[model samples]
Target: MMLETAFTPFYSLAGGALIGLAAVLLMLTTGRIMGATGILAGILQPTSLPDWSWRAVVLLGMISGPGAVLLITGQLPAVQVPVSTIMLVIGGFIVGVGVTFSSGCTSGHGVCGMARLSPRSIVATLTFMITTAITVYLIRHVIGV
Candidate 1:
């Protein structure tokens, strides 16, 4: 939970401001929150064929923006995770399925929806958080994984 010195308080504030701005802008422009998983799921729907070019661009930026920043700065921090590649892929797939079933991702429900005080979003976000906490506890303690 601790940010490195390279990620100063100013950087953290700026990043948060950018996220807030992006979410606000997206809501104002498209009546949609900037949630990656929801957008990705929307792209996957076969019936949604009314110019998803913007969605594609947003997704591409989500994927490449960090890399672009690293390229510009010539310095990228290493990400350390204990899980294997297969576990990571499986986890991602499970998360995608969960988000689809829940009708929104954490960013959508937990951030934007909560800001608007949506009851369904509050329930969904709480459920997601509780489930995640229990799963982590079971994995780290019961299963020792």
Candidate 2:
């Protein structure tokens, strides 16, 4: 099979800008890094009521994003999962493991951490990129899946 990628530069740029804006706003307001998994985990096992409140709002905002798109564009964004359910589950499990080992996910390290010139975040982001590239190569060429 052949691989094809849709080059949606404008959409990608807009999305990246929004993500950066959110990270900045969250940091300025709460002095906390906007790591998605960390936010969810915080909600699951909160330290305080105030901590849980902000995390809940962030998660709610994430869930309501599709509704925001619908209001603006008159339709919800189309989502396509190219991989099977089992593959998705396995990928999620692997990501969970990575987050546990790394202490943060891509949003925290790649966006917030790098923005703050954090050495650990820089290394973690580099590792994430290298691992991602190798995984894609193996999947597309070796496994041909």
Candidate 3:
């Protein structure tokens, strides 16, 4: 099958700008890193009610984008999963392990950390990019999946 890549340059740029703004706002308001995994983890076992509340709010806001789209456009945005459920589960497990080992997710390292010129975040972000490239090559070209 041909890989269908949607080149939505304007949408991508707007989405990226919004994400950057959210990261900046989170840092400015809470002095917290905008790592999705970290936020989820905090909600799972938050140290305090306020911590849990903010994490929950962040998670809700992340999910509510689709609802907002539905309200404005009369439908949710199209989402396509290019892999099987098993593959998705395995990929999620691998990502969980990577996050645990790396101590931060892409939003933390790639967006915030690199923006701050953090050495560890720089290395982590590079590793993430290289691994992502290799993974896509293997999946699409080598495995033809």
Candidate 4:
């Protein structure tokens, strides 16, 4: 079994707090849930649409925040994934497609949806979890990828 690092608990708690804060702020201020996937998809919509710029900004911050922190602190965590660039791109594309078809990504369905007690979000979240579990099992055990 893989053991967590010494900083794991602190990092997990900090991450959870940040997520909770973002969710609360978004709901209170914009009356919308803070879901990165949904925010990113909104940016891809028409430029003439209202509220697209803020969504884009939010997505940008979401992408850049960790990088900025790592840059400032000079302590970026190591990534353990051994997949090739091609496989990474393919995996990302598949995830994008899956999120699109499922109507929301895990964060949207699992976090915000569960908070709101939406039945559809509950089902979608379960589907995401189950699919992820199966895929990981296949990659690590069956295919040994």
Global lDDT scores for all candidate models: 0.79, 0.90, 0.90, 0.81
In candidate 3, what are the lDDT values of residues 55-123, reduced to their tens digit? 999999999999998999899898887788998899999998898788788898889899999999999
lDDT of 4 by residue, 1-145 (tens): 2324466888789888888889899899889878867888878874655689778777878878769779978977565666668878999999999888876876788889888899999999888899889987887788886
Candidate 2: Cα lDDT at 133: 95
lDDT value, residue 145 of candidate 4: 61
* Of candidates 3 and 1, the better by lDDT: 3
lDDT of 2 by residue, 69-142 (tens): 99999999877667778888999999988897787888989999999999999999999999999988898789
Native-to-model Cα distance after best TM-score fit, residue 16 in candidate 1, in Å: 2.8
Q: Please list all clashing residue pairs in model 3, or write none if there are none.
A: none
TM-score of candidate 3 on Cα atoms, chains taken together: 0.92
TM value for model 4 = 0.85
